[model samples]
Target: MWRLRDKYAIAGVGYTAFSARSSVTVRDLALEACGGAMADAGLMPADIDGVVSFHFNDSVPAMAVATGLGLPGARYAIDYQAGGNAANLIVQTAAMAIEAGLATNILCYRAMNGRSGFRLGGGRELAAHGVTQYTAPYGWISYPQAMAMWCRRHMIEYGTTSEQLGAVAVTCRRNAALNDRAMQRQPITLDDHQASRMIVEPFHLLDICLETDGACAVLVTSAERARDLARTPVYIMGAAYGGGPNQGDDLFDAMRWPDHSHNYARYIADDLWASAGIGPDDVDVAEIYDCFTYSVIMQLEGLGFCAPGEGGAFVQAGRIDRDGALPVNTHGGLLSEAYIHGLNHVVEAVEQLRGQAGARQVDGAEIALTTAGAMTCGGAMVLRN
Candidate 1:
């Protein structure tokens, strides 16, 4: 069967300093990250032929970034109107394009002024459309409130506790303390998580991810070309992007779906592992998307690291610590690190596979799993050195 395994590699990864606010425009941030990725790969702008990015009307278009970089000619360019879910999808698309011979080297990126401009967790009015038409009127407008329902259901069904969720927050903060690029570096204890003001019924202020202004970019090329690049080739062993039925049109459709405790990862894990030809035991490090502390738990379960309803316990057992059997979110993740959407998670996975993650680097890391989004639609990829 045809597969993307070991065919394309992420030749380089780059990012701008994450901050609560940036002095520059989102366009400039995109340019800077793209340029850095190109430089990291030892490729000039003229060598880039494809550009891809995704955003929710909060970032620049791929064409704009391509123009800014002064690409001699862009054969393929697209910008999907999406959020964190598109992080791995963009990379997958770039790999497919390279495999199809449509582009030699593709630059994928996401840049946003999330904190300074359009705050995802803020009270911005959502379009009263499909699911929002029914829920928004009842003040179910923001992501925290919507996702809190999932967390609450998991608690009732599996007896997941606030303390278990706190473990995720504390562990991620500890990892972030070693990441100079992370926004929230100070470590927090479970007591601190319990004491923090609650956002929704089951979520604390510490449980939610950070909103930061920054950008991240990566360069994808054939494995052959990657081996000759400036950086070590981090091969894309497996990739999957999608969700259960009807999730594409409305994410909140998950509410009516049968499984309230699980995310899209439940459906995609098999394909991800099959494509990579490895199981959860083979992953040396993980960068699971942690838009919320509960997200990490849910994904850990959905991705087959443990059986369903056991995620809370899995996290509480210290298995996700930096020195644990499977270190997760080693660069702090979105919870402690800046939310450049989930592209930064991809960058962290690349760094781990390359053995470039400094203080929090997992020992002898050879394979990494990076995921984006959790609740409804999402994407994931397995990378190896």
Candidate 2:
């Protein structure tokens, strides 16, 4: 196991109100979230020495946010290349930086105008690249089409049904209703999910995540330093990030794996557990990435919440409800809540651990598991109170 486990902790978290449209630029959005986080941690701008962010270079960079916050120039600033699946890397990288004595009081954040500015799913000129050469030519132009293909395969092989998937959407909306910061707070029922417009054959409009305009930030420092912070410390128990075998290779060729139905989470689950010295049984709450309902189901299976092909049944049993065996996405998640990439999931986990979540708080959340996406690349982190 790594000595770094539990060495660094999240002292505070903050976010801007989620919305589909925001007049401010992404830079301002980042400042709002960072300022809130700084205040929550009781830290001054001069205290921060490091920063990290992900997704495309289009979003505000780490240095830009640092400057906006009036910080003494950062000693370590990184702009990671991966997208949503690499969200947890921001926290993990900051932990390593602090452990290495390279910096202290790192601010990790993500901000974007996903709806009004750069449409995440907007058409881009294909570069005729490696993977694009294989799939894009066959009319698999968007994530919906690509993920739909995977969901269809799961349905055929595992007997997963659209009704089972509807349960995920229903659960998220129910959670969103209790969160004032969420963009989509209106309650939704499974019947409403079925009645919603179809984005793809098996996926409905409600099944997809909202294109949100928002920013989320978290403050990380040594666990000892966190003891002096304004908020209770949430320790980083475990974390891992990497690609899975056969992911995004060739749809047909990738199917030859022994467990082809599995996602990248399967590759990192053991590392996350071993590093934390805990298993699924120790988890009090989960914040699974829910870019789509089907993806959440797949992650549940991969994370060992249930056996393979049993995810649909697991969710159908209400095992992931707020009061169920393992409450998941208690802050609405990306499905109904605004998508600030996956940083909001981390914030929610911190709140759950600190007992700060008001109505949506799980009764006694002590160990919270927050995850990024599946597919080609992914990450997960275990946070403990």
Best by lDDT: 1
Model 2, global lDDT: 0.86
Write down the TM-score for model 1.
0.98
For residues 47-128, write the lDDT of model 1, one tens digit per residue. 9999999998888899998899999999999988888888999999999888888999999999989999888777646568
Best model per TM-score: 1
Looking at candidate 1, what is the lDDT of residue 328? Answer: 94
Model 2 lDDT per residue over 167-219, tens place = 99999999989998988899988999999999888788887888989999999
Global Cα lDDT for candidate 1: 0.90
Measured with C-alpha atoms, the lDDT of residue 287 in candidate 2 is 94
- Span of 10 residues, lowest total lDDT, candidate 1: 246-255
* C-alpha lDDT of all candidate models, in order: 0.90, 0.86
List runs of model 1 lying over 4 Å from the truth.
Answer: none
User: Clashes in each model (backbone N, CA, C under 3 Å)?
Assistant: 0, 0
> What are the clashing pairs of model 2?
none
Q: Score candidate 2 by TM-score against the native.
A: 0.96
